[model samples]
Target: MEAEDFAGAAERKAPHGDRGGEAPRTLPREQLIGRLTQLAGVGNIEEAMRCLSEYVGASRFMLARYDLLQEQGLNFIVTSNWPFDLVRKISGVLADRYSRSTELEKCIALLQPSFEDLPPECRVPPGMSQRYCSLLFCVGRVRFALLLLFPDHMILSQERLREAALLAAYGASFVEGRSQRNDRDFELTEREVECLFWIAEGKTSDEIAVILGISRNTINNYITSVMRKTATKTRSEAIAYAVRNNLV
Candidate 1:
């Protein structure tokens, strides 16, 4: 490394044209990694939604979990933004329409973002307004959609859009992984999940027996089986797992 060589290299450095004479703002790769890993550690849907809303500088975000089938299809769980009734109404309409778009369908299939021009055929319901949006990404098993909303004509930077789409993928991964964990978190049968749901609401085994129309001994046996299957030594631990896994 000669000093002249170093001087020539420095001379070759171009002015940052995009920054108006200032240095270009940069996020450290390590910082991005930490942010991503933090998102990955997110335990469930709500936390994932909160992280994404904050990350993308959005007023709110919507996470709609669906199951795509031919008939009686598209069951949804929408979190974030709008009243419950609004979410329900809007989702019911949008799921079928959005799923039918060749572009949106392709985006979901590829797990990629597809930017759409707005006032799209997938129109926003009465209360929402946006001129454009990116489909972001979807996770198939959960059949989740990540839609970002902003004021009309607010152009999203390519870099930011890429970051948001990447974040959506991570969000989807965390959600899917947590659901899989919940599926395995209990060794309990459907009956046991029902029992735990009631017990977590402060019902006793006797109360649960009455609710399920089973005998007290049968209820006890179910509880024991639940504890064994969930690998929880006590009711408290089982409940803790339920709470942690969002099963209740």
Candidate 2:
């Protein structure tokens, strides 16, 4: 059940549709599952991430919490092996894109994996992955991302990355209490929170008003207040703020 015990415990399936590495070092599927089942009990995120890193053949990785409303800011970065300058260069670009993306798109992309080439200034070792395989996950209303850097030119199984994403999310829950230490002084009322909850669920303002037994104008006012309190410029941004802070 200890995190240390999981190191080198999970078997890896190489890219190209076949195994080519020293297969003896890979841990079996059953053991991997059993270890994941015990993930919640493993309290240190770095140790947990290291365990996952070994399985993926990742040279390094970064686990961070993102607020889609912010142009550039991580609520907290649980752990990362990324070089400092590299993080500084990429963070703003990443946040801006996240902030600009529509709510519908953000919802659809949740827990879905993506791969992107690293910035030219950021170079990895020859055998390291040139592309970053990123995955976003949510807990309550907060969103987190795991950017795992595996080996280069090798086609990693998406199925395996998905499992790592799930496991990393579970492990990160214990880190910083999953953004619980963030600001909660928004003073959103029960009604406002209810509207935000429904809004995040894809409800139209009119639809929410009807469900909450209120006028459309009232629903609009609640959302407007939320935007003001969160310093967001739009309704979509307000909802994104709620999601980032786990308020919804």
Candidate 3:
């Protein structure tokens, strides 16, 4: 906290670095969208992100796919301007945490932007914020997370960030060459989740029928559908799947 310390910091600062005193330029959301769309059209994730970094005043960008069922990180990743060792060390933690949620939580999280802190070891330029803005989505059986780190003291409009989340989904789809990851709810129908919930509560099909004012056969059919969709052989197995996936 000495005056010399502040002077020393200024001496070390480079022009237009992530934390340099000079402010980064901001763009209109419409213009940003148009540019990202054009950049993404080239079918290059890195290229789109290179432009994104300049706009967001961030040092890096990363897209990670997480497998919620397996509790592991998928092989898919696109990053710019990040250290290799840092990515390797923290990618798993980042992926796991973002992808870890119940079916209900996933349902509510759609397109909702949020922030999280990185590990202390993940270095940025002096005074750059260590926070990451995350946007999560799902495709078929896979879940994808887009992360961006903004420079310290720079104010980014949340409106633009939300649009960035949606556009990032498109960019990811373009890069992965597959559209639709089976939808964010994993294609689980409402009645199916209801059945899964009741079963997880130790309810027998007959009891559920009485509570739901449906025939026993209909309740059995719902349970059957849940098992088939989840690929579980037994009611207990199906319920376990639901619980593990945070569905119930």
Candidate 4:
């Protein structure tokens, strides 16, 4: 689905409250599960995201591809209902953080929800929180992060947040699965993709050899094969190509 379809879909007025505006009414666990189940059958990523946002009392949602965060432009963004300006400002920060994180840290972070304060210069909407929530999940080999905005000082349910993340992952699998099936031009092997992932994480051939429990020369061979298949002359270029195309 196109990003424009849901870019501003979550900008509706909030419920009236003493503190300017109230948090969106959160869905109970059972109801949330029911809503997500129905959304799964509908196969609409935007709606599923909106449902999860509201179910967790969030005001806005931006679903982005974690792997492509380091790439230039907004191609990393899968779908978002966050403001265009805010997205542009925050994406660079997220990319920088992703680049600094180890590969193991990223894997352990999957399906976990974390919070971060917005950049000081960002102009948050009235009654919205300065801190935002982010949850990561994987669909096959690809990883995605769901960034959320909620009302100021609003306490969100941990259980619901985790549940929402899983449902979001489930919803995304359908969309991404279909896309992968139709686009098979890369045809990189699993081992080759593994090498690309490590190299992207800044691992040298010798380091990757130890990590994968293979010979250094074997690791070099895998790198060579990846470069050849991806038509990249250097290791950096191959990793760049892999990041851009979400091959790793």
Could you say which candidate leads in lDDT? 4
Instruction: Compare candidates 1 and 3 on lDDT and give the better one.
Output: 3
lDDT (10s digit) by residue, model 2, range 33-101: 556446545555676776676555566788776654343354456678877777776687677677677
Among all windows of 10 consecutive residues in model 1, the one with the lowest summed lDDT is 8-17
Cα deviation at 71, candidate 4, in Å, is 1.3
The local distance difference test score of model 2 is 0.66
Tell me each candidate's TM-score.
0.46, 0.65, 0.56, 0.79
lDDT of 3 by residue, 1-248 (tens): 32222112222333223344675665655776677777767776787766655665566777765443233343445455666665665676664554466657866766666676778877765656676667677543346666676666545545455566677776666655533243333877887788777776557888888878999999889888777777789987886676455565
Report the lDDT tens digits of candidate 4 across residue range 92-197.
9999999889888998888777878889999888888888888999987788999998776555555566777898998887776555321333577888989998
lDDT of 1 by residue, 1-248 (tens): 32222112222232111222333344454555456567567755565565555443444466654333222432344466644554444554565565565643544544443443343344454434433334445453234556555433222344444566666676567655655555575556788878767665456889888989999888888878877877889887877676556555
Q: How big is the positional error of residue 222 in model 1, measured in Å on the Cα after superposition?
A: 31
Segments of candidate 4 deviating more than 4 angstroms:
1-43, 181-187, 240-246
Residue 51, candidate 3: alpha-carbon lDDT: 64
**Candidate 2 collision pairs:** 10-27, 11-27
Q: In angstroms, give how far residue 80 of model 2 lies from its true place.
A: 0.9
Q: How many clashes show up per model?
A: 0, 2, 5, 0
Positional deviation of 133 in candidate 3, in angstroms?
Answer: 1.7
Candidate 1 collision pairs: none
